[model samples]
Target chain A: QQQVKQSPQSLIVQKGGISIINCAYENTAFDYFPWYQQFPGKGPALLIAIRPDVSEKKEGRFTISFNKSAKQFSLHIMDSQPGDSATYFCAPYRDNAGNMLTFGGGTRLMVKP
Target chain B: NAGVTQTPKFRVLKTGQSMTLLCAQDMNHEYMYWYRQDPGMGLRLIHYSVGEGTTAKGEVPDGYNVSRLKKQNFLLGLESAAPSQTSVYFCASRSNREGQGALGRANVLTFGAGSRLTVL
Candidate 1:
């Protein structure tokens, strides 16, 4: 069974627009939630992350809005740029689980110049 | 510094052939992992090691084996390659001594450039 689900397999937005990707997880065992960004020919990298205790966490133009009660989290990219066009994944992890992460179906984002 | 490095960035193999993908980390981390990424499927863990001389199966460990002979090296081996195994494999590592705070970056994973394997 898919423990995590992500919406909008693909997305396209203007350079100045906002790009949002949402994810829902079913595992209550998860505590640390992180989002990863992947560029073609490269491996996924850490973008930003949030814990269940916080409702939101932002880093520069990237923000992670989390809803612990809803078991949902979303990534918001403000002023999306062409350079930000890439695949994004939401990986929920449990610390005691040896930090093993369960990834969601990836969202391919494309920002037009 | 090379945080994490994967060897043979690209390879092609025939069914039933055996091969090994090597992962090396210079971060002195105590944990290492192997994950496979497929189109629209995100990333799936194949196996992982928490420390040298110890390995554990992950969500999709079948048809794959892993060994952590040294603190800086983790090796993933395929006894018999299959077409279904064709995918981009990633190696990631994190320090086990990271901060214990719930919101700490201990869960952060630093990944390598990845190895693309094609089985015919």
Candidate 2:
């Protein structure tokens, strides 16, 4: 069973357009929600994250809108650029002694020039 | 600053072969993790360590073992490689220091380049 589910396995967007990816998680105990971006030949890097307390969080063109009651969250990229093309993953974090992240399947995004 | 570093970026092995993948972090993080990325399966944790000399299993720990002998190092070992084990492995580390930096949720996870292993 998938605790965290992400949709749109792949996406295509034009430069300066808006791109969106959605995810839904079943674990209410998740302490934090973070998104990761990965390019070929490189490891995933933290993009942006949000706490369940907040309805939304935005950083530059990357925005994370979270709905606590619905158990859903989505990432929106405004003015998407070609450089933004990469794989995005939604990860819900858990902590024991240290933080552990559980990732969704993944969404590959392509920004067309 | 070499946030996280993985050694033997790529490796190939046959069934029954044994090898170890090394992970090192310079951020002085207390938590280190080993995860495998398989197509369509996302990234699944294999094992993890909270501090030096401690190790614990994750979702997929059947064919792997891990050890954290030093504060900055975590090692994942495959006792007997199988074709099913072929995938990209990632090592990551994180500190508890949050609510700092530009993002309120600071001290986030830092990942290595990755180690790609192929088993035949």
Candidate 3:
């Protein structure tokens, strides 16, 4: 099984502050990195994703920064709000037939008012 | 559309009891998966099916059995529930159409609200 390491098991940020979560993968074969957000008692939903071809991809207040050489990717949330508080997971996959997506430990984010 | 629906949102079973979790998708997806989410351990795949009448074991498939009799439905069964099996189970589905999305067709998975199961 491929190992996925996520940082900051937990985080706390003030409203309007930036919240960052990191993920490191050991497999270079992975071509797609996606982030999922899960609120309490709810299933995870796709938040954002980035292909290895691009270094960074941003949508609204969320951004995904990828580093091919480093085999790592990070999610940055700018001006994060209390509504953004949730558990985030980094799921990377090879994007090929029969390949299963690997998920990280997850980072719990708490945004204070 | 009820993307994916899981039955028995919450269930409690005795250690030796048996129960099955049903996952139904209305999107006509060909691929379906069953995953168990544990605290601090992330979600681990228990079983997955690429099409009807086919099933494959995943990372933690020890005491779980899965069957895909219909394209839109996947069932997970536990012969005998155990305390270790207490966790949240999630069902997800994806389309088989290629080149449907920019990131690729197999990258996205629409998950169900999840079912909470506990074995006493």
The candidate that achieves the highest TM-score relative to the unseen native structure:
3
Most accurate candidate by DockQ? 1
DockQ for candidate 3, C-alpha atoms: 0.51
Q: List pairs with backbone clashes in candidate 1.
A: none
Per residue, candidate 2 scores C-alpha lDDT tens digits across B1-120 of 878989999999999999999999998998898999987677888888888998888889998999999999999999999999999999999886554433447557789999999999
Writing each residue's lDDT as its tens digit, candidate 2 over A1-113 gives 33788988999999999999999998778667789999887899989998777789999999999898899999999999999999999987653336446688899999999
Stretch of 10 with least lDDT, candidate 2 chain A: A93-102
DockQ of 1: 0.58
lDDT of 3 at B50: 87
Query: Which wins on DockQ, candidate 2 or candidate 3?
Result: 2
Error of 3 at A26 (Å): 2.7
Clashing pairs in 3: none
Task: Place model 1 in a CAPRI quality band.
Answer: medium
Q: Residue A76 CA error for candidate 3 (Å)?
A: 0.1
Interface root-mean-square deviation, each candidate: 2.2, 3.0, 2.6
Model 2, runs deviating above 4 Å: A95-100, B98-103
Docking class of 3: medium
Ranking by TM-score: 3, 1, 2
